[model samples]
Target: MNNPTKEEIGRILKSSKRIAVVGLSDQPHRTSYMVSKAMQDAGYEVIPVNPTIDEALGVKAVASLKDIKEPVDIVNVFRRSEFLPEVAEEFLEIDAPVFWAQQGIYHEEAKRLIEENDKVAIMDLCIKVAHAMTKTH
Candidate 1:
């Protein structure tokens, strides 16, 4: 997989304002929750995209990416690697510019699909870490 440069990651973080977090957990202790909370605290709009949850991080959750009415800058995924292809398919249907899979989650096919569409695909990376490193927030 091609990794984004620190500058590229910083550019994305600086340009993006709204993020749709797929598989975001409602529990505060969960990594998804913690990460999303951090992003929210950094002034990014974190939209929870999980069918199983009603809401997360004080924001009303949507069942899927397609359910989001507002434009999404990044589709931040927290699902396992095995589920990436499926999520990638759904991502293609949306207008988001970036597809991001959190740390420990990487799939070549998903990356191919997203990049094939001329969209940014970032895998096996933590958005928060990238954000902190770039100090984009």
Candidate 2:
């Protein structure tokens, strides 16, 4: 998997404030839940996108990215790598500026699609780590 340059990661972390956490879980033990919570604590507004849940982290969750009427700065994904193509398709329909696959996930085609669409594509990077990295400097 191709890693985003540090500069690119910094840019994404700096510019994105409203993150749509795709496949975010309601259970606090899950990685998605933990990361989203950390992000919320870090001052980024997290919008949970999960079809099975009605809410997460005190915010009402939407069934899909398409359901979010507000602008999403970044689409932070927690789904498996196999689902990225579908996720990319949904992202294409929205005005999101960045596509972020979580720490253990990456999909080449999806990355290609997101980059070709003039959006930033970041894979296999923990959003919390990236955010912290930016804060240090």
Candidate 3:
């Protein structure tokens, strides 16, 4: 689904503590960098997943989700919609609970694939915004 209900969003945010950020950039100007930084500052453990970068925001970067050894609560994707299918495949491999596409990023196929596997798929929403909203509760 393109838009998740408030309860579902809250549940995901409340349950998730460790986030894997795919396509995260080291640059401060990038949205991924800013969002992940905010998440880290919020006390969530943020793991950086980016092949091109060695690290992001002082966290070690893994090339892919498959490389992550620890349990990942949320897979926050910063990649474009066109790349989500590949990201979705990785999510399935890792059996991630939540697959979140950042603001302005959405793919029906990816969403369908994730939801079909009974995982929560959040699209076109910012993780920082969701987390901030959930914190108010």
Candidate 4:
């Protein structure tokens, strides 16, 4: 995956405040849950978007991006590669500033769609690592 510089990532994080974590799991050991918890503890308001669970992190778990009422600053994706296209489609339906595809996630077509229509920022990186890297500088 193409990783952005510490400075660039930090700037993006600083500019973004509200994040919708797609495919966020309820299990404590899951990547989604851990990342969500880290993000929440770091001051970002994370809205968990999980279909199976009704709540996560003591907050209501929205079934989909469409279920989120307010505008989000970023949509953080943790789903598999096969689901990216559909997720991107859903993302286009919403009004967000950026689309973040975590560590192992990436989709060129989805990236193109987001940039072409909404022109939102895309970061295919680990939010946790980004936070750690950002804090060091």
Candidate 5:
């Protein structure tokens, strides 16, 4: 799969303000919660997009990407690789510019769809790590 260069990824992190975290959990022990909490600490607005949860990190959660009425800069996914294609399909219906699948999650079809639509497709990478690396100068 084609991945963004460090510079390009850095730019994406720097420019993005709002993140729609699909599959984010309300439980603090979950990796999704920890990483998303870190993003919020770093000044990015983390919008939880999970049908099961009511809220996470103080922000009210939306049932899905379609439920988020405001603009989203990045759609950061926490689901498994097998579920990516479906998320990618839903992502296409949104106005977001970036499709990011968290670490250990990657799907060729999902990546292709996102890139084919002219949006940034990032997979098998940790957004928190990217943000930290980029801020290190």
Candidate 6:
């Protein structure tokens, strides 16, 4: 995937109101928790999706992306690269505008699947880091 420009990242962060954070963590030490927090702090609604916990970062947690009925503008992933295919599969079915795989979590085959749909934006980038840069500008 090509590196997203700050302008592009800013537009996505500013425009995407509701985000589904997949593989979100129950523990504070995890990158999932940190990244999710960053998104929330940046003014995005983050629906935590973790089967092990019912809640995280004070937001109601759903077991999976399919469980959330509300509109999701972006589905940010924090899972392992090998597990990305499954997450991508589930996210593609949703009506979300974007499918974002976080840093170190790209699956070429999976990315191809998500991008095949012209309606959705398949991006490989860190949501939190993107927010930081966007905010800086």
Error of 1 at 23 (Å): 0.6
TM-score of 1: 0.98
Please state the error at residue 85 of candidate 5 in Å: 0.7
Per-residue lDDT tens digits for candidate 6, residues 1-137, read 65456787788778888888888987999999988887787678889988888898899899999899899998988888898789878887788878888887778877777777754444567877777777831
**Model 3 lDDT, residue 125, Cα:** 94
lDDT tens digits, residue span 1-137, model 4: 34456787788788878889999888899989998898898888999998889888888999999999998988999998778889999988988867888887888888777778855545568888887878722
Worst 10 residues of 6 by lDDT: 116-125
- The true-versus-predicted C-alpha distance at residue 122 of model 1, in Å, is 0.2
State which candidate, 2 or 5, has the greater lDDT.
5
Q: What is the lDDT of residue 89 in candidate 4?
A: 91
Which candidate should be chosen as best, given lDDT against the real structure? 1
| Candidate with best TM-score | 1
| Model 1 residue 88 lDDT score | 95
What tens digits encode model 1's per-residue C-alpha lDDT throughout 8-108? 99999999999999999999899999999999999999999999999999999999899999999999999999999999999999899899999999999
Which sequence of candidate numbers ranks them by lDDT, best first? 1, 5, 2, 3, 4, 6
TM-score of each: 0.98, 0.95, 0.95, 0.90, 0.97, 0.90
Tens digits of per-residue lDDT for model 2, 1-137: 66678887887787778999999999999999999999999889999999999999999999999999999999999999999999999999999988999998999999999989988888998998888887822
What C-alpha RMSD separates each model from the true structure? 0.6, 1.5, 1.3, 2.1, 1.3, 1.9
Sort order, TM-score high to low: 1, 5, 3, 2, 6, 4
Clashing pairs in 6: none
Give the alpha-carbon lDDT of every model.
Answer: 0.95, 0.91, 0.90, 0.83, 0.94, 0.81
Name the runs in model 1 displaced over 4 angstroms: none
Candidate 4, residue 98: lDDT: 76
lDDT of 2: 0.91
**How well does candidate 5 score on lDDT at residue 66?**
99
Between candidates 1 and 4, the one scoring higher on TM-score is 1
Q: Once model 3 is optimally superposed onto the true structure by TM-score, how far is the C-alpha of residue 90 displaced, in angstroms?
A: 1.0
